[model samples]
Target: MSSIVKTNKFTQALSDCIRSNPKFKAGQSYADLSMWTRLCVGLSDTEIFSMLPIALRNVWADEEIHPLLQERGAIGTGRFNVQSLAATLVCFRRTETQNSEVRVLQSQLAHLSHEFNSLSFSVFDILKRLDRLEAENVTLKQALNIGGLSDDPAGLPKTETQQISIRSDQDAVTKYVL
Candidate 1:
């Protein structure tokens, strides 16, 4: 048989298989399937039109798409067979699903990353406040120590031990004025 005849038969068979498969029929329109086919194979319109049945067969028979095609009972041989084409379509569909899932996951990761940055800033601010407070506490403790106050066993200043000192010169001035 001529290669052109085989290619047409193969294309028809693939179309039939897609229509018969409930998942394929429900998930994509003919136009959508066509577009996806081109996208998945990264082929131009002229290249796709001129592609041989063997080339189409090889695409579906790839290691990635073969197993899925077999699971769907769409594997076949010959120019009249649609199994290869059906497999290619299924593979494209799977790729689309995976791409969508990846997008969702990426979005979630971005949100989480943002939240982590915010939390880090908050923690840093808290640490800075704690350090400032610690320094102030140390300075206050030193001042209390210099003011003739002793820290009790409970870590508080002993207020009863505090005494006011008066200079003798000031006392004599008060006596002279009186």
Candidate 2:
């Protein structure tokens, strides 16, 4: 197959992948890194368009992409050389399998990220419910004039529950901000 077809096909495949997964938010670091990694792998270390298939060579060499890929080590600036591309390919291609493993790990991280996002939302929801319940309880206590504050706030389990709650709450808050 032509490298153009191959590169286009690869780009499309990556695009489809990100599109299918809601977790792979566009413009995010993960998306950028994934794209760069694919480009690094697909472009065979940034040789000229001629070195690739005739159709696909100049397709991605737009002003915007040229510098970006160069920065990512996908392409060299100005000219294209088979030797450079070969060296780069040799150096990086060896790592392709390892990179594949990293990508798998990254995908797993993405899955965990989705899970953590869901769980964090759930935790926040529970905290909101707890707040509402606590408010209602306080109202009732005030209505009944249940006097005397708890003498031992420190008696609350300071170990497991509190730690988990604090960590979860912090995580939720952090995710929300992000």
Candidate 3:
């Protein structure tokens, strides 16, 4: 009837739910307590205290310890009804925590992807510059002809006729002069 009674019932029920949960481990005791506290925040102060420990008991070393702790946490007054409320609270807290972690991971992944893209583009730019340099080097080698005798003519490679088409006006002028 009173807020304290309801809160106690909630807390006991919560502890029982925790003990039953398969996801949690005894090693994560601090997490267990914190989760219990968060769950209880939604209920009345008195109900929260009653239910908080019950939820905490749910985190055990194994199945063997779980039943013992579950019994201890749920033995008090208003045990039956409040257990359900405590279980609901735990589920809510777990989901909320999981969702928050997912969002954080997604943001980190996005940042890494952006960095990878930038690095890839930079590498492509460098490769493009190198290719241009190679073409230019070939052109320079043809022009210089280092160590070639002036008269020992290895003539430059001939351009195709299509590559250097004569102007029609120039051809006409040459013909008239001839």
Candidate 4:
């Protein structure tokens, strides 16, 4: 099989793969490396990638993407290559999978993740405020010499008798900040 003369990092890797892997010793060949010559054929890789759904676009630079594709694109510079997209297209086309549904689901998941993080931070802030208010409540109760289960009916776990002991008519006069 004829080897590609226009060698680059991507082509070299493909040639190495053809030579080393046992399954390709007869079926595939260095001739396949010519595919890399069209890396930017009709349109720039960015334009082609932008035309694709996010599912295929992910193959170029995702941390979870295969090493070959990750190497083909520059994540820092947002550079992409037709070789990577073509490889990804071949893999997906074999399964006859639709990428639009995948892209929609991924978008929903990302949105949910962002919302969950925002809600988690809000909940954390609320808990901190509650703790501060509880502390303040302690000081006020101690200074006023007040005691009651009615103060915080949901206080520490208690036996029925303990529950009865802390209640008082003073619940009517008590002021709670929470």
The model with the greatest TM-score is 1
Q: What is the lDDT for 25 in model 2? A: 26
Per residue, candidate 4 scores C-alpha lDDT tens digits across 1-178 of: 1112322333344445433533332111233323322332343344334433332333334443335433443232232444454455444443333566787889999999999999999999999999999999889877555454344546646887866665643453464422
If the candidates were sorted by their TM-score against the true structure, best first, what order would they fall in?
1, 3, 2, 4
Clashing residue pair totals per candidate (backbone < 3 A): 0, 0, 16, 1
Residue 174 lDDT in candidate 3 = 92
Q: Write the per-residue lDDT of candidate 2 for residues 98-134, one digit (tens) a residue.
A: 8889999999999999999999999999999999999
lDDT of 4: 0.46
In model 2, which runs have C-alpha deviations exceeding 4 angstroms? 1-92, 146-178
What TM-score should be assigned to candidate 3? 0.42
Instruction: Write the residue-wise lDDT of candidate 3 on 13-57 in tens digits.
Output: 555555576543322255654555554565654454454455444
Whole-model alpha-carbon lDDT for candidate 2: 0.55
Off by over 4 Å in 4: 1-97, 146-178
> What RMSD does each model have against the real structure?
12.6, 25.2, 11.4, 20.0
**In model 3, which regions exceed 4 Å deviation?**
1-81, 146-178
lDDT (tens digit, per residue) of candidate 1 on 45-68:
343444534544664656654555
lDDT at 55 for candidate 3?
42
CA displacement after TM-score superposition, residue 132 of candidate 2 (Å): 0.5
Could you arrange the candidates by lDDT from highest to lowest?
Answer: 1, 3, 2, 4
Evaluated at residue 89, the lDDT of candidate 3 is 52
